[model samples]
Target: MRYPLLMRFLFLTFLLLCASLHADESPDTIAPIRERAMEHQKAGRFAAAVDDFIKCIEEGSKTNRTGRRAEYFARIAYNQTRMGNFKDARENMEKAPRQNGWKDEDPFLMEMRAIVFLATDQIEPALQIAQKFKAVNPKKAEYFEMVAQFFGGDEKCLATPLGRFLFDPEQLLYNGAVARNPKDLIARRRRAAYFLERANQQRFPNSYPAKIPVDRGGWAHLFDPATAAGLPYSFYASAFYDLSRALEMCSSQDEPFLRVRRAGAAYGWNAVAPKNSLFISAATIAGDLKRAQKQGALDVRTQRALGDFFSETLPPVDQPNYRPRLRSGIQSYSRALYFTRDESSLRDPDWLETPETDSLQKVRAARSTLIGFHLSGKPVALPDLPPLTELAWKDYGNTLVAREELGSALEAYKKALEFDPEFVPALNNIGTVYSRLGAFDIALEWFDKAVKADPKFAIGWTNRAGVLDELGDVEKSLASYDTALGIEPQNAQTWVSRGILAMNSKSWASGQNAFAQAARLAPQNSRYAALSAFAKFANENAELPKIDLSIEDKTWLSNFFGSDSLAESYASKGAADKVFAAREWIK
Candidate 1:
């Protein structure tokens, strides 16, 4: 107690330092406020708890008390729910302060809000919010199921006309009726299948019923399980499968229309290329070519068919396989340098040798770099085409065309036509090339001559329609499309083209119908599926609110319904974007 002043000060400093090191740290400065809020919440003083939590959150916001901020927000949300303030709770939950790298806070809040809606029997709203949450975070499959169970009630809701046909509880009894009343069965089933297939076929493939979130009441399962199962190839497998079977099952007196129906189905499904947007199935085209070559005396129709096959079988527009990378010494040296270089600088030459490699690497480094360096606002310069000796000017013209020099392409085509005045393909190609360059008049002149020379050419009719459409002559364009369809009704692309024209003409009903028909013909087409959904929504009585046009159209249910209970109820458990996209068509 009587120690010297300096010794006492030194001893006190050491003691204070020791105490500071051993102090029980508060993770959040507002920890006491968070604890008080929880206590108030537990005592059923929800409003008081909310007030305290809000204060805590405000305090945390001022300071860097992240944990306390989240705790307060989470508590406030819970108390709001307990007080039966569903709307307030939803707002609070949605506005819950996000913590850097803090897991589960946002989703937990979303899940709680969904529960509040469910407690109040706001089934639709519950489903919509749950679906939004699920879409944002797909790993939570439970959220999807939660909404689906409510929308897809144990007994289907008898709300709409389609529901009467679709939500039949007495499935087994209906099956028995189909067997006994064969004619009626054929009629009903055919009509039912037609409508169902129409619904199934949309412009966007992702819009298929199956693609709808499982949480939205499993409506897609309607036809796939019951009605479609009775058909030849289940409608589940192919939308046209049941229609095809119906054609076979129907009476022989119905032969002519049946052929038309069958042909329509064939065109829809058959014309669609497998895998991607390839115009024709390579296997099928190859087989056709082999047959045509083997039978040298094939008829004109067969020859033309082969030509059509050739036209469609060309490589995809984006991923053209024409230019294979040289893969010569340039690539070998590049790889060799990578192995030899020990220092990063030495590897510089390896990168330099292969410009594409370095460019690709830069793209990988950052997408912005790729766009800035390679694909920015630069014009595409075409490489000169190798000279063709037959006619010097013609060769020059073709070289320009090959380089995507539109003017040059037109000039080349003209030169080629000058050399061989009766070259039908060249004339047709010239018209198409010119049409692409927006030279409608010139394109029309050439197309007219091509059609006159080859009256039965389907391409001429299709191409003529394209030019007509560009020229804003929709009615005539539609006529041309019809002419093309008459020659080849099974072409899905042509159906799509016609459907687009119809849509552009404000024939939403007919446009959707046409799109549906096209989708039925090609079940796997995503664009067709999406368009079909849009069409159905257009026809349906369900209201679609006018959302902001600036928002990116998701083409899915989750996006449309958003946090609304009814919207959530119909959203897909799996893909939300497609579901939101579909919702727009509802009104």
Candidate 2:
């Protein structure tokens, strides 16, 4: 979670080592204080550490370590940099130890100074420092040249005039920094901050963009990189290259796909550019992300992120290739199901799923809408590519389920099983589809296979139990639920299911205990709360509490959703927010 720049990593690594580096003046007092401050900084609690470090610097005796004073100042500047205290970061960098021979030789000092100057209004100074450093250390010349070109101050850095006409210096600073460090994904994503800025700038050039917080390094402006404005076309092209390169370089740790949307690639120059090359480039990267998933190069979150990004960024609504784009997007979202992480604990709205939809079923619905539109005429044909991995086929099958193409969904699921015979999700889902078609006996066969394939999968066990319960095999269902519970004791939904099953069988004590566990595990779930309350009443021979809806809360919910019937239902459950949720509203 704490992925730092290489130098920042060094700064943190040294914090504890140099904790007691102060020369003897209350070294005992200073060491612990310094250690805690450094710990706070590592945890991203900058304000908490600032006061302690300041106290250490003021009260502790100066140590005789080489460049100790300079290092101390640099540490302060590093913290200041994170907090957007550019003024103090710059001051500290200036006070840092300089070499007797030449200051440019100090890479850390030069890098920090350039960073500070770039952030502030001193573009020229930053560019000059970068140029000197590039000369001092030619190996990092790319970074130096990028900074100089970013400010549009020195022609020597650029083979030709880059921004020959004009643009704000601040824009150049971020852009140049990214160009200088093309492989650094964080630097590359800084461009996303300019989304709104580029948008409004289209109609109002040479004017102000939105007022966004620069402290977070985002720009709320009205300038698009695609438009031939003060900056040349090459500038936008370079940015496109940077993003593509970053995507290629990205690993499982990043939500790089979603970052495309956050970066506003769709609305940035890529969306607005006269040439379709940028969009094409992005689409290519989208493919690369998929290939990465196939090769197991990406993490589950990245796949999910890409799936979300792919759906959201699909070549607008009117492109000729929209159908292929839709399928691709759906397939991407399906990747979320491939991971085995117990995501029931994830409470993010973006990750919400259903029995059929899982995380990406919503994207499948969008695909269906497009599919129906295509059926109005002869649909655009998609070029056939090589088959995807077993995981991708499973994803495609999920889309088929959403489209109500049940037979075709089965075929896709079968294909998934072909690639990886033991893939449990595909096996379980096949059983689910058969259950839908009233083939309970056949569905049970698939469920048996699923549990056999991956006995450890808690969901598979839970699904098998639910199916058995539906098919009038109560004894088998109860046993299956127990098996699932044994595997995943924290599964709140499983507890709730077991509670309901026990209640149906008149096992009052068992029902109450199960419901109580469910409520304890998921207190916010209205279903769990209602079931637990009911179970308690049944067990204790007590009356259920009457509903007490507040008039204010009811009215607010009614007005927000514009539907009294839905509001009343939610008001009963005390789940006002869920009243207008997509699944609920659709139902």
Candidate 3:
């Protein structure tokens, strides 16, 4: 899977032509050493290849192909790895700078160092280097997988962020640095991670709120054992994982809903500990009222209002089921209305006039807001919005974003922020829209605002890292990526993005490794597969497949993503040439 093999071959030919086009050095002077290194690398004499490439780099100093020099260093690092010189390879490859032109240094050399370290039972260093590489390019899937393997797979590592919850109350899921869980939590975690990954990948669809990652047994099913009992154990396992995440959120905040959820879980589990006990029904309301009173000033009124809202809103039950839930929802809503002036608008006559009127009015308002803000590129007014607790704005914002009416989406998001100035999603969506509009600086501002709002938001960190990479702020991008992976190591998209950035950095060896990771994380992604092949071929210095300008290639470029330039380029020179030439411009 090296650099779409066809693209690789064409790129090599292009590179060769570029070399010939420039009279900096005779082919004879450089070719012999390069060919020798290629031979050694091909025959598995990696050490020999390293030596030859090193010499070639020194000899090429008379020329100004810093890119070429970097490429050689990268390849040498790859060769050193086969010879088991992991430390040296890593040290040397780190010196390579990103190419100014199209040249990429050996993409997989650093990846190999980390890979081989793991193969040699060097877990700690492998993890560290792997994390470093991923931060530079988080899109590499294989690298992420390798890192996960070292930590006992996805589920085992979920415990890293919440050791107490994921590993059991006593943290007994692992023994002396190895996973002790036999239920295959690792694989389950990986599967569950995909739900989140896909949710993120869907790019906030244009109609419905982008799909939510709902796990029946995980967070989705944590409410009742009866619901979980209907599903397979695996379903429950994933649900538990989500529940753990939800609980983690609760532990970090004093959110009333989360607290209620905890009380519910405790009630469901019926654990004897006081912390594990829960109150439901009227008792739940009483508890909320008590908390409000303790905080002072109209807290009691707010709590009672919530109880009234719940009593009116809760659906009639044939039996006494879901009492706790009703109480929780009511209390939650009451707090929302009590906290902010903006949310008070939810009590507007348009909404309270009738249920149908409320629904339709809200939807129209959301649409108008999104259109006004994002499409029109107007500054959002933060005044006269709903309260943060109402969550009306979040709901409306998500609705508009789903419709692909980015302008409308922006407004809805802006309005949400007016309600909750510290809301993460509002900040995130605003940044996304700004990025779409090529307003990178403004996007960075919103993303920065999101990070400031909730430092624990992994998605914010990852997306911000992506913006930084796009802006060519490689060092800062790497730092942001580190923050993301540290928060959510299982995010495959982050791995892939990291990989792409690494490749673009002109450290060919590192790029190749990053691509490998991207491919592994998303095996079905054609881009990842193509890049993987390209990276491998580039490192080998072997002939790449000629780009076929055939109808098929044309269709792939034109019909698929409307890549007319790419199709034309491929038609004239080859697919590889077209891909390389169009890579930056296409996206």
Best by lDDT: 2
Give, for candidate 2, the lowest lDDT window spanning 10 residues: 214-223
- Return the TM-score for each candidate structure: 0.29, 0.30, 0.28
- lDDT digits (tens) for residues 438-551 of candidate 2: 334456788999999888888888888876765445688889999999999999989978877776666667888998999899987766665565555445532222232122
lDDT of 1 by residue, 190-241 (tens): 4334333433333223544443312111123321223321232222222233
lDDT of candidate 2 at residue 273, scale 0 to 100: 44
**Models ranked on TM-score:** 2, 1, 3
Whole-model Cα lDDT per candidate?
A: 0.48, 0.55, 0.48
What is the lDDT, from 0 to 100, of the residue 51 in candidate 1? 86
Which one wins by TM-score: 2 or 3?
2
**Over the stretch 144-247, how does candidate 3's per-residue lDDT look in tens digits?**
44333433433444445433222222111222122333233333233333323332223223532534332222221111223432222223223223333333
* Candidate 3 Cα RMSD after full superposition onto the native fold (Å): 28.6
TM-score: model 2 vs. ground truth: 0.30
Off by over 4 Å in 2: 1-184, 192-238, 244-271, 275-290, 296-298, 313-324, 337-587
